[model samples]
Target: MDYHTIRPHPDLSSIVKCYWTLEVPYQNDAQRQLIVPDGCIEMIFILGDDVKRFTSGDEYIIQPRDMVLGQITEPFYVLPSGDVKSFAVRFYPYGFSNFVSISIGDLVNKETPLVSLFGNEVATALADKIRSAADTLERIELVDAFLLERLITKPTVDGIVKRTIDAIFSTKGKVSINTIVNDDSSKRRQLERKFLKEVGVSPKQLGKMIRLQSALKMLLNNHTGSLTEIAYESDYYNQAHFIKDFREFTGTTPKAFLGDEGMILSSVFYKQD
Candidate 1:
């Protein structure tokens, strides 16, 4: 398996963190990969064989074509049916809402036809353009073009969500609702409702995930610190709190996570900023 990421068009940078691609040769031996929560949403287009998805014990197929998946709240797995190739976009917590009509939360852990959200012809055209591109750069460029020409621009959602995300991401999970709310009265509740509706997880959950991400990086970078020290550095309440959050996010203790082959992919995605 090979994975790479490219920067998104400036227009989408506010919500879309980056676009990524994964290519794996046809191999029956390679059982599909199961991806868990990373506190973000994504839109993926399969350029090769049909992508098989399983969630909530439900099996759905993403035709060897274009599809946009909503926020992922639970765990899911995908197996390559054949010469597996895919292009995916990683959207920041609230990024996807600007482009789709439905409340972003309604789409979490769900893969819906782009036609439903974006008209059928437009979705198909974009998918075809991406698939027909000669290379990743070309595909990325096509994606850039598609968004520029066809993506719906919502100023209100854009301003509110973007501001909130900026506060959290810039602070590296060291902020709270109060910080994001600024001086708006009832800002905490308003932000919470919007965040939960648009981003799937609450601001606090994303903050914890972000902090865990920072701590994992510090440890992996050989910062010469104990888990306790790293925990404090990461801004967890205490060592025990750190341990609990770490396990909750990663499904394993920090010590056990180190040098674990099964966790290699997750580690790469979660390690530090």
Candidate 2:
């Protein structure tokens, strides 16, 4: 697998984390890949072969060629039907809500066809442009133009929500929800309701996902840390707590994940990011 990310245009940087591409050769008996949550949404365009997302041990639906993957709260499995070539826009936690009118909560744990969000005519045109672009640079330019138009008409994110998200990422998710709320304890419930509507998960869930991402990155990149040390660095209470949370999202122990073939794509992603 080959994976890489590109910085977004300056104008879109606050909303878009980056643009990423992945290419993988096809094999007759390719193994399904594990996709862990990272507290962000993605607009994905599959340019090569179709991909399958499994909802059960033996069942899956073919993913739409162009779609938005909502904020994921749990890990899932996916495999390519053939050669895999994909381009995607990774949005910040609060970014995607600005693009469409539907509640982000409705999109959780599913691939929403772009047509449903943008309308068929507009979505078709955009997909065509992406498919016909001469290169990645041209594709980026096309997407940038599309988003600039949306940005003009869409409402801005709530000030509190934006700042809280920023703080979470800045602290690598070690910041507490009370701190995110700035001790305005009465607003916590209201904030969580709004957060679920716009971000597809509560602030607390996003924190856990981001914190796990930090530890996953550490484990993938450095081989020196003991599990306890990694747990500490990631701000967990202890090794047991870290492993428990990790398993909830990844469905496997950290030690097993590092060497699993299913983790190849995830490993490459963490290493590159």
| lDDT to native, each model | 0.71, 0.91
Tens-digit lDDT track for model 1 on 16-102? 788888776887565545454666777778877876765446565654365666655444566667886888888878767666666
Query: Which candidate achieves the best TM-score against the true structure?
Result: 2
Off by over 4 Å in 2: 153-155, 182-185
lDDT of 1: 0.71
Q: Put down candidate 2 lDDT per residue, 51-157, tens digits, no spaces.
A: 99999988999999999999877779999999999999999989899988778999999999999999999999999999999988999999999999889854489
Model 1 misplaced stretches (Cα beyond 4 Å): 26-36, 50-65, 81-83, 152-155, 158-160, 179-185, 222-224, 270-273
Please report the TM-score between candidate 1 and the true structure.
Answer: 0.81
